[model samples]
Structure formats: structure tokens, C-alpha cells
Target: MGFWDFLKPRSKEHVEACWPGGKMLQVHMEYDTEKTIFTYFGRFGLTFNISKSQLTGAIVKEISRTHSVLQVYSGVDCVGTTDILPTEACNIMKDWLGQY
Candidate 1:
């Protein structure tokens, strides 16, 4: 598959929630049976990569009906936490990791 294909969420809820402002231009992800490499591309030259085999968990907490927080943990460290919309986006990420 194409590099960005995995970034395409399966549901409309994911499309709206994961990319609230349409700021994401593309994404590149590579994963094997046990590890994942994720790269994010934004419209305003914003980019970051998270490649970790020690991902401990992904937690989703609701703040409102349309908003939630996604917290990512790596081993004992909280690597990333950010707000998302619709909430289902959190599950998608978690499921992606579960596959590997």
C-alpha cells in the first residue's frame, strides 16, 4: 500500500476527529509485526516522528461530546497527549498498535 494509506481512517467520524482543522497534509507510517514508525505532516511545516516499540498504552478520556484527549504512554513515560474530536480516532491508533 501507499505510505499514507494507513492514515486514512475507516469512518467519517475519524476523518473529522483526527484532523479537526485540516492541517494535516499527509502521514507516513511503517510497521512490522512488533514495531511502528509514525510520521505526521502538517500544512504549516509542522512535522514529527514517533517510532517506539515500548508503547505502553493509549488512553482516551472524554472532555465533551465532541472532544476528547488521547494520551500515549511509552514504557513509563507519557510520550504524547493531545485533544481530538469525535473520540473514535483514539481507538484507531490503539487498534493500529494492537495489530503489530
Candidate 2:
């Protein structure tokens, strides 16, 4: 198996291993609608947008989206990048895990 393939499942397993205190979250970005929504436990939900940055806070706790917009926010550093948007999803995920 490829390195990425091996790493992917191992990482996911690590996440799963940290459940209850942790969660499997789904973050959805609708390209057609320009909306972002988060789903948890396949039911609980929350949503966000670039315009509503204040309520979400300076650091996001987690994100699990299917779109590349998450990539656009990932690893970005600038007032324009972070002030208007939360930090990268991966950054949030790492922070969450470290809390454990």
C-alpha cells in the first residue's frame, strides 16, 4: 500500500480511538450556496460563514469538510486570511487532539 493510504487509515483510527471525549465531525462547504455547515453524530448540526467570523472565535476546534475551500484556509497566515476566517481545519484538529 502507498504511504498515504497507510497513513490515512492509521490517522483515522487514532481519531476514532479518541472518541467520546472526541467526535467524528462533518464539515460541509456548499460551493453552489457558499455556506458552511457542520454535522456531528450524523445529526447534531451547526453552520458558519466568512461574514460571521466573530461568533466562531479566533481558533476553530474542529472541521471535517469535503471541499477544497478548507485547503484555502489551511496554513494561511495574514490578517486578511485569519481575521476574516478561522484557522485551518487541520490546525483546529491538532489543537483538539492535544487537549486530550
Q: All candidates' lDDT scores?
A: 0.50, 0.28
TM-score of each: 0.50, 0.19
Candidate 2 residue pairs in clash (backbone atoms < 3 Å) = 27-64
Residues 1-100 of candidate 1 have per-residue lDDT tens digits of 3567657774333121233233352322234323344433332333444565666776777878866755667787777655444466555555655554
Per-residue lDDT for 57-98 in model 2, tens only?
A: 233323334211122232343211111122344354334333
For model 1, give the 10-residue run with minimal summed lDDT: 11-20
Give the poorly placed runs of model 1, Cα more than 4 Å off. Answer: 1-35, 40-48
How many steric overlaps does candidate 2 have?
1
Give the 10-residue window scoring lowest on summed lDDT in candidate 2. 77-86
Highest-lDDT candidate: 1
